[model samples]
Target: MRLCVPRAGDPATATAPVAVEVAAHLLGLVGDPATATVAWDIDWQGPLSVPLTDEHAVQAACGIMHVHGRAAGRPAPLAVDYASTVAGVLAAQGVCAALLARAGGADVTRVRTSVGQAALLALAQYLAAATADGDDPEGCPPSRADAGQELVPAACSFVSADGVCFELEALDAERWLDFWRLLGVDRADTGRGWRSFQQRFATATCALPPVLSATVRRASFTAVRSAADRAGATVLPVRQDPLPPTVTPPWTLTPFPEPGGTTIDRDGTAAAPLEGLRVVESARRVQGPLAGHVLRLLGADVVRIEPPGGDPMRGVPPMAGTTSARFSALNAGKAVTEIDFTTDAGRRAVRDLVSEADVFLHNWAPGKAVRLGLDADDLRAARPGLVYAWASGWGDALGPEPPVGTDYLVQAHSGLAAAVRPADEPPAPSLMTLTDVLGGLVCAQGVLAALLTRLHTGRGARVDSSLFSAAVLVPRGPGRPAATGRPLHTRDGYIALGPRARQRPERLAPALGLAASASADAIASRARTRPTAHWLPRLAAAGVAVTPVCTSLADLARDPRFAPALTVGEYAAPLAPWEFS
Candidate 1:
């Protein structure tokens, strides 16, 4: 699949992940050849070539594997193909964005992305926290991260006396304290545990006091749930349901009452596809902000709409400058305006902003938009060509009174917990906020698709995405056990073998001075006899791709291959995952 770039010095040809490229040309899509899309599992040519597999992507990117391993209390690989799937989704999104750029008279010719980069993007928040300046900010949660261990134990995903393993969520410390106190926990332990649990979404580690887990361990699931209900918290049992026969796409684009009514009037720019476009984003936490950030990366003018005091997360721990590194990672380079949406005047202010904006986005809980008179109908009435987006926890999936639509709860409810880990390990939700990131990407993708659709229809569309939808995309995969796809344990650290080595283990056995055929245990024992450095070159010489497991995200900046994927600033941040070659 050649991506026919028109510009000289641009990529003359590119291929693999053929659907997007094929769709662009076959559908008579016209964009600067510069905006054509191509994707791959990994770069075909690099300083060093690694095998193309989800395992390698996660391990090398310092991605979700580290967080999953921590939650599972071991150096375990996830059973599902998360990185590759996300990469594919992102590739499709790039195609839509490129097409949108063309409609807006922008020259976007060649878009390139890889599973490795997508994996890095998925771990952006953790990467931010890892490279932040100073200790955690004041009033922040207690962090108990241990750099020495391959997997740090997390006090998330509790099991009840009735054998029900479930996820628990509380947005505020007060509710967290109340829930545990109702469960008969000591006030001191609950206080300490709240810090770790509250920050788990930011730091991938939750070292809660053992007493918290113990308290829940002695209670029935019903009793635990009763406490959560009374405290305005939420608890969801880990479901082991079969994959739905039909999974909904993570987001949908729908034209409103009319079509072919509008086209953006701004002049397009050469530097980025979405340049000159304005995105008015009113969002909290990761999902909505992440969607807006994606647009910012694509060169849109993203104006963040915050409450009067500004987002409280500005002070979240591991500060980069004045704001939390995690917040900076998602919202840097975007403009911010504080509007007290609780007042009618604030709603009017947002409406005024929306009057000239290309996109209006939010991630408020269900029905909040309607209650605030900012629903799609309300705002689109003011600006008929507006692309309205809602990035939420659930997209009308669980009805009006849904359980909190947070990432971990969605994971448990959708059986993602079971899908991500082996059967032997108890169902555990990775603290990496996987669904939230994916949902945000889904939201951005939907918005781009809607924008592209508006090119013909001349009307703006409503886009919706949720963590629940994202979770469904990854059903209960028959995950690999802890024994499968494990890295070789060397004296110094671990080194992951590439797809080629795993596929042809017989060849690898001889390189390790083993019999013609080696059992995994024999090879593991032999590999441990030497240091990681000693084994890497020898394995490479024998045609086995290898890389050190990026157990620590702080070290990711030092890996040469990832240089293009990150920028070392006040804190480390992932670059836009796609490359316009």
Candidate 2:
């Protein structure tokens, strides 16, 4: 099996240069770089690097805030190239997994993923439900707040008197009273309900850091963190320094020499490398389900087992009638089975499923696997050659793990929140669940490598990835150049201009009826004089990267390049990024 990709300099292609570089890195992992090929598509450009055809348009119109409830019209701070890089990484992982299967004697040929899919995948957790409609009425809370923003009463950063910042999350409704008691707030002054209490707290903390700072100043950071942990709350010191780039590779492959368990033969199987493979996915939330989703796209048979009430996400917001658009999007290509894990029968059924599966994946809280008898050793005992993958908040190497490892918490601990914050503002996490998405991709990569090893040694291996580790792997540096082409207002709508225009200022000047030496402000002023219709064709003819800002998925659906990617029926959906040739 040979992996062929377009070369970086292919004259006819506009694939992202970064995407090509990432693809090369993945191919290097397989130890056979000579077999890969690269081609160029003339229509491709940097903007095309984003998987979705018109994502920039969407962000521009929506204002892309990380925390909900901000005024919609506020323009987002200058954007960075997050979605494309993540898309590149995930695409590489999918291809590598398929190639591994082929190396293990499966007759697989190709694998693919798009930048749009990567962007959606990263936001899976947040997008699974609508803001006001689902099981969680409050919607996804802000992971952290900017200095002057309204802090989420339950989960936010509070500074100590010593000027040290600590993140605290105590979101359980039933525990509000308990939390008040723990904080030594008098019960007599406690408000009537959760809402009232929230209001009171909000009023008291109107001064931002000073209010929370004064409250926690009575105790040391260590004491506060310890108490928060003891009360089933999550607390961590806010890491201020940017984390150095990952010193260790994102995925690790280990080979076992011992012979054991059942072996799968790929002979006469369908062309997809994983066509005959069976996967038992006992995971919930973004990380595990996403890993399963990727494998399913590559033609593996994935059975997602949920507890009796179904995965909690089934009831998340932004529903399309009775179905959760978020849940359906991530889980569209797989089979689902509900088993009551609390019963002995359910446990046995899961064990039986594992015995026949090529992979077993889960992201249960730490120690829960051991309690449920679903640890790597127990599952491997049932199917000696089974690939077991564990996704968590933090890996075992981070001794004495915290009680919680959600994506937001991991962001705070891993320095991601601080890195993205403007120098003058309080820390704000990425608007998307960046860590969860990356962790899922890394999990798939590890499982694929283990599968390859299993084919050779007939012994399975354990693969681990954590949100913390994934966050660490994301590259951070000086921000990319701002979209020099600003969005220009016209009679009808706004049009994106700049990037391509910057490259050919001579051509852009004539299209916008401006002098070649015109400043950006001058060009913008000129563009506003005409309606979008008058300028779109003229600018486009000159090869300026321009398009109307898309306000919704429907807007993107109208584009020929994006129409095929839309999954329309009872509910509208975006198809997974990858495609097999």
lDDT of 1 at 164: 90
> What digit string (tens of lDDT, one per residue) describes model 1 on residues 56-172?
545543545665565444445667667655665666666666666676777666566666667777877778887887664211334354233222256348889998988899999
Off by over 4 Å in 2: 1-12, 26-80, 100-112, 120-166, 175-227, 244-248, 253-257, 261-271, 421-426, 478-544, 558-560
Query: Any runs in candidate 1 off by more than 4 Å, and if so which?
Result: 1-58, 72-75, 136-152, 242-246, 259-261, 266-269, 475-483, 500-509, 515-522
TM per candidate comes to 0.87, 0.75
Which 10 consecutive positions of candidate 2 have the poorest summed lDDT?
200-209
True lDDT of residue 93, candidate 1: 66
Alpha carbon deviation, residue 410, candidate 2 (Å): 1.7
Per-model C-alpha RMSD: 4.9, 6.5
- Model 1 lDDT vs. the true structure? 0.72
Top model by lDDT, which number? 1
